[model samples]
Target: MKKSGMSLLEIVISISIAVVIFIPAMNMFSTTGQAVFKTRNFSFANSAARRISQRLMAMPYEDIVEVPLPGIALFDAPAESFFAPFLNTSGTNSGAKNITQADMPEFYSYLVQHDFRYSLSVSNVSFGDGDEIKSVGILITWSENNKNMMYRLYVYVPSL
Candidate 1:
């Protein structure tokens, strides 16, 4: 009677072919996962930067200039979130609402559990013939697989 199963050589050859295909397929999946992770971090940075920028724009020019947040070196990754001090705090000024925990969703919480860090810079700049504007810069940095990633946002707020 004819055998219904493959010989040992046939089985080994088939297994080798499967391995060859599986290795590249697994590599592709790993690469895609990294890309998704990187993209997610970038999206969060963009939204956080926008939220911080808007907060600075809403504040009276004096506040931004006088009470700048602690600065972070662009290349150094801090052990904690730099914006933690500015979050969930009530402002001394009446009708002033500094960013609260609810104001920026997942901002503080994510930083608490993640490597993401941020910094803010407020500096005076001459606009045309007048010096009544301040340039606000927000830097967001994080590490991914031992690689550093950063995002920068700039907005100008006029003295009020």
Candidate 2:
């Protein structure tokens, strides 16, 4: 009998080869997707940190809240928030006054959706005279794929 189409064995072999090639391709695509997600999150954290830093720089030296070392934990907690005015607090407010979902709905929403949180801390930097400058630090933390990540922005603000 003359063969008109692929034999069963031939077909099976071809399918097996295709599967072997496609499986790795699919896995590569999945890995690429995860990398993109990670990059996106990093970018967002960077942008937000810069923005918050800018805000801190623009404010009067006295206006910025000053907390001792480890004043605000790097984690999310309303009571110990770094951005006081922007923090959303419950009735009879209590916390560090950091950024929150209530005070900053849009920014907070992005943080909430991305599982990001931020905290701020300020320490006296005695240069020449009394409280001539302060060291400000903003900490942004988030969880990605069950891993914890953080970004810290620190700068010195001279009294203006």
Worst ten-residue run, lDDT, model 1?
Answer: 73-82
* Residue-level lDDT tens digits of model 1 in 1-160: 9879899999999999999999999999999998897788889889878877877877667767432333443222232233433434455434332233454445545554446666767788665655588887787777667776778998888874
Leading candidate by lDDT: 2
Report, for all candidates in order, the number of backbone clashes: 0, 7
The weakest ten consecutive residues by lDDT in model 2 span 73-82
lDDT of candidate 1 vs native? 0.65
| CA error at residue 94 for candidate 2, angstroms | 26
TM-score of each: 0.66, 0.66
Task: Give me the runs in candidate 2 sitting further than 4 Å from their true place.
Answer: 2-6, 66-110
- Local error of candidate 2 at residue 141 (angstroms): 0.8
Candidate 2: lDDT over CA atoms? 0.70
